[model samples]
Target: MNFTDIDPDKLFSSTDNSNPIMWLVWIVPIVVFMFYGQRIQLQITSGEISKNIAKLVKYKEESKKELLDYLQTNLKATPDAAKKIDGFLEYFTIMPVDFDPNGIIPKIKHLLRSREDYTRQQVKSLSPNMDALEVSKVQNLLEVTTSLHLLHKLVRHLFLTAKKQNNFPLILPLQMMIPFIMEQASALRDAVSALKQGQPIGDGIGPMVVGKMMLGTEKKTITFETVCAEKEFEQRKLYLLKAEGPTATVGRPGDAVELLVLKNKPDIIVMIDAALKLEGEDSGSVAQGFGAAIGGIGTDRFQIEEIATKNNIPIYAVVIKQSVKEAITLMTKQISDKAESVESQVFQIILENTKPNQSALIVGVGNTLGVPQ
Candidate 1:
């Protein structure tokens, strides 16, 4: 074992294979690992994936159970309501073709309206005893259930396909995404209870703040499930818009803004909404920016931007930060307390940007569930 006793001549010896013990102890295993390392990796990762898939299945089942429990306990649904709900799970929509990109917004808008109407009708028919607010919550509950079902089926399909094919590349992506997908599924699972109870979520902060702001002001229903409050704050005319709340819907902020702009002719548009916080960012932080400030498919954002741009109105945004999970789940104390801070910041933005007698349009964008004007 001395350094001087080491043989430099045998260090790179190709003839070392002649030693049976050396070959068995070192070379054989190295050769085996070299040939099968990826296979071993795939097997280990696949095992992990199988465990995650099991968890996903559990979450999916739990969500469906929560839905059925709500139906039976809250709505006194029939015993065979389970069979009726199964049909809602398989509902799918065909997206409008974009071959002609022009006029796509109207097309997409029409489809979205149709989908919402159809879903509402389905929810109403299933829960005839439920009121308007209950109907909205039930519709949202059904959405969460449907999403969990789809998530489980999709992940299971990929898992089986990759396992069957013995394909490492296919499994690699799934392995990497397992953590995120699990987080989303878990969040969705928890959101079921929140939605069913009509609790305010992180996303509701916008509406909550604006709902408070417009407390003494007269409000109008501008569009489908959307509301606008006309108020004068410190010599500035303010047009505040938010989803009509205590109902689980985002409403149509874009249409509301467009209608308000044409009718009232605001000088500046300020939007408030809950934005997704990056990792390590504080959950209840507030940030300022510009533009539509709306989420989802970007159609509504586009509509708002078009109206603002056409009218030469400056668009400003104030955002409350929260994570994806917090947005849908019950409102955290940290996030809920930001309502006051965001309200002050919004007033600051309006005062700093607009002069006295100038009209400012403020739109609070998010689900208004459990928060009312």
Candidate 2:
């Protein structure tokens, strides 16, 4: 066509539907740009997520190595022992059971007890030279290490899947959940530090209080793995029970309490534990109330309730508040410092609720990590 015959107005006019080529000319570049731009975005996002997954894998490996070194140095654990422990750690870390409402506590308790027994047996077999305390320490280290390893694996998997699917929506949710993941990871790291240093964890505040109360007192082995002692407070003969610690175990406190109730027949049963605080609540704040202040599978709490109810014993609970993150991590200065106040409050509760010369069972319900009975 001659240049004079081509009308500039006709070429640019949208109303001119006769020439569909004009429409294609305008639409083609936009479609191509969008398609290629999306591809580029997916590539960049996938690459970034892959790098993060790599870092997490590296972290998990480093944590595993540290745990292995600690086991070897402290427990004199052989390679076979280390391997068994690793397997045990991974088994518990994975926690094959999902949360169920009906009879969940019993199921959890059964699993935990079985796992504990298996782990103890393995530890004993692997580190025959190590004493109970050393075995406990090793177990604590394994628990902390497993938590960190599992967290890393979970986040890495999520990141990889999000990248693989090239789903920005999926990735956005995962990114939003990162803060929670990091919080848990940080707590696990702190827990590892506390376990290695033989320091009390925040969750151990209840046990620490019991330990302090039982200091200089004679402790008797109430169960195969639990201990108890007697203390005189406010004219009331208090029976203090806790897991024999410096190790990381809940130590059959429920079983110990059962034995104590049958033998001592205390008037009031007071249980202390670390409770998860709400967002606004200060960590280490003490609250006094009723019911079992125990955490974990409901076995221990159920035991306490069953025994207490049958015996017609009034159950009182004293709890030290901590964040979910703090509850599992190292004992903060705030939590440690609150121990004395909690003790005082506990004493007051006992005095107010009981008569002089009346016996009371004070059970500290938590993992006795560094607190000794």
Candidate 3:
């Protein structure tokens, strides 16, 4: 059965051999298949890119949400205040760090100098009859604005140095802390703007009222009138000191200040200063106590505190919570709050010491470092 079973004529192969059409049909599909396969691989890579982009968007939105919550919870709002805490956060978050030697620092210095000179000229041109308080307010605004740039440079230096570090220790903590500072700075900017516009200094207290309040604070008030020991209480108001540059020092318990205190013989001396956080302390925590007064260094703060202590005047301190950076950017709120807090404490001290000593001085110390004597 096996030997006779196969018939060659009926079996498998019968062909004329090579055909060009067959080669073309097979090759064309193979080429198309390879091309499609590569295209599909590329599509997979593109899909990965899209996935990463979506993830980045989600991450950014979450970050922004956290920032918003932090600001709203911590900051207070007022109609009179210019820089909302949120504004500062927004400003610093986007600040560019590319340093150029020729770009920033020098330009800021030049602009500040020019602005200062212009302010001096404007003051010189003021009429003798122009309200002195108005003139003084304008001058102070100009000076503060000009001086702020210096503080900004200091901040920039810190930021740049932090960026250059190999290991940025507490980087997240630093980031969290900086936004608070930005808020404070924004508030400062707003305060300066209000001052320039000659808006009322306090809610209901204009500069005139402020001057009067300072003069009327005690039976024997010391001011520009008392600066020269002259009795020009009629023509001269208390708050108007002669025009001095930003660096002019005021709080030094020098003869001028001492004489004022001696004349007043206040029952208590309460000093308020910005206190920085210790290494591991919370940023905005207040510390109240007593310490040495190093004269002549800080803006009249150290000197005045020193003078009060040296005279055996009972000294009390109210230190507001702040970072060193935050302290530099002072809006009126910090100063006002600090001043009121000290004033209240001073009164309390007087009540506590019923039979108190006659002469007392309330010193507002701290980085009076920059304020000239």
Best by TM-score: 1
Compute the lDDT for candidate 1. 0.88
Model 2 lDDT-worst window of ten: 92-101
Decreasing lDDT order of the candidates: 1, 2, 3
**Candidate 2 lDDT over residue span 29-76, tens digit each:** 788877786666667666765665565566566667777777677767
Tens digits of per-residue lDDT, candidate 1, 182-214, equal 888888988987898899998999999999999
Q: Each prediction's Cα RMSD?
A: 2.9, 6.3, 18.5
lDDT by residue (tens digit), candidate 3, 25-122: 57677987776855444455434434433443343344334323422332221332223322322322222233764454335434544654565455
Model 1 CA deviation exceeding 4 Å by range: 1-21
**How close is every model to the real structure, measured as TM-score?**
0.94, 0.79, 0.39
Better of 1 and 3 by lDDT: 1
- Which residues of candidate 3, in runs, are more than 4 Å off? 1-130, 147-181, 197-256, 261-268, 272-288, 291-299, 319-344, 354-359, 362-373
Clashes of 1: 0
Worst 10 residues of 1 by lDDT: 8-17
